[model samples]
Target: MIEKTISGQDALPNISDAERIFAELLTGLAAAQPGFPLAQLKTFVDQEFAQIKHVLHGISLLGQCPDSINAALICRGEKMSIAIMAGVLEARGHNVTVIDPVEKLLAVGHYLESTVDIAESTRRIAASRIPADHMVLMAGFTAGNEKGELVVLGRNGSDYSAAVLAACLRADCCEIWTDVDGVYTCDPRQVPDARLLKSMSYQEAMELSYFGAKVLHPRTITPIAQFQIPCLIKNTGNPQAPGTLIGASRDEDELPVKGISNLNNMAMFSVSGPGMKGMVGMAARVFAAMSRARISVVLITQSSSEYSISFCVPQSDCVRAERAMQEEFYLELKKAYWSRWR
Candidate 1:
């Protein structure tokens, strides 16, 4: 909604869609738990909706949605859902405490493109205000930036958040529940014959995720791997199924390849010329330019002759990648010493 508003695809300052969705959610919650405090939930939702409206109004005035505003909006959604979940748990006779991770647990930096400050987060978790006896229902994805602004971890960040929390708390295992049962030989939807993987090493899971497997966020494996914490990918719909386990050791399988993953909408760029041969730091310079542009290179290969280097990046980054290369190698291109192709 924020994106659409900023792009002029949505009416400025309009939050009716968010309003209707939350209303339905609250209505369902009320129906599900008649004894629950629906009034309190409604009040909380109203407060959030008002704040969202204020942000939308600011966006209208600025004609843009800044990272701060975007992150705040994302935090609000997570906050509301966590609150609702807490209410449901409370209604079930559990003593639930809704903890905002930003306020009580995780501390992050880089605002919208946030990464957890592990030391700070661990310190906060150690000094946590939540009672140990209560069922702690903490908000995921959202964290407080260094400036105390509400910020979000990146996409599929709840998994990353869980992993970070597991490592910080030194939990025995981290379970990531999703729609699918677990990791498979390939995406089961595309490859009907794909076999369900029982277990895989953290390295294997990370590689698969980096190459486009959707079971876990690529960064999710980092903290767990570092801590040697086991991770389980389970199906929410089928709890009885023994989902894939990811740990320090790999399970022996007869098949050599554990899974097959593929990335789509890729744009390949090639740099080739006689001037490229035996060029010291040439490859380094090529990647350094990409680093400066914050564009991730998915794959790279060099010719045996060392005359050319080819690399792939997401197609969406083609324009920026091209611009960065042009700027970085302006002299070489101008001198006709090397050529670039996409």
Candidate 2:
């Protein structure tokens, strides 16, 4: 029997839902068969335990900031999810300060009780007084928009939060740790031969992510690129491996196309009529209708003759877009001024 050593970090309340589901699965298997591949199950559980330990160890190492650099950390999710990260940093003899970004900036005012004054959160992070050697961990969520309303950055808002923090603080670099080593030329799950990119330009990364690469959020690049900060994507389980780096520029590589990505469930629409030829407001009316319908146009093209316009949007929005156009051009449709292409 192998003896295992455990610490408080080992019991962190992260991924509890996952643990519950796993437990239920094992329970069901055990109930069905008294001896149902217990060895395989045990091996899987052990691997999970080891992965957790590795994560905690890697986080602790991050606390050892180099003399030349000052570090700030941003974490997403509830406080319980981040406790282990904070606890481990403090255990390593580093002063750890936990802050809520909403408290610092008026743009993202307090949600329930308190009020946030008119202050920019990015400015606050840049001007923080915490010692260079100390560490600050921010629990991040949605931020405020220009209207002072809470705006969630979507499911991957955490990545946006980290980039904002790094850009504000002018950190040397920003790193994101995930399950995979780095960004691949294509999704490895679909293309087993997909190659990992050691480094890529910000433009390439942005296009890939926007087109459908899931490694990074589309918004994650905005702040980092605005400040020209290099961002790295690394594996939490295998910290030793060099992951992908995204920067303003990289050495020219032989590959002209970085990777292939795509989006599904999309539809194209074409609006055409002789009345649209040389008409200035025709395109505007069409787009206005789409805007009013809250349908996002993905791609757009117009014929050189100005007699027709074509655009692509999410397939789910096809009906909405069509309805909006019909209402906006009811008179034109009734008079045969224009017709919608199927």
Q: Which model scores highest in lDDT?
A: 1
RMSD for each model, in Å, please? 2.2, 14.3
lDDT of 1 by residue, 169-243 (tens): 788899999999999889888998999999999999999999989889888899999999999999999999899
| Each prediction's TM-score versus the true structure | 0.92, 0.68
- lDDT of model 1, residue 291: 89
lDDT of 2 at 50: 54
lDDT of 2 by residue, 13-85 (tens): 4445555665566556556554454455545654564555455455555644221111111122233334445
- Where does candidate 2 stray beyond 4 Å? 1-76, 105-119, 145-150, 281-287, 292-294
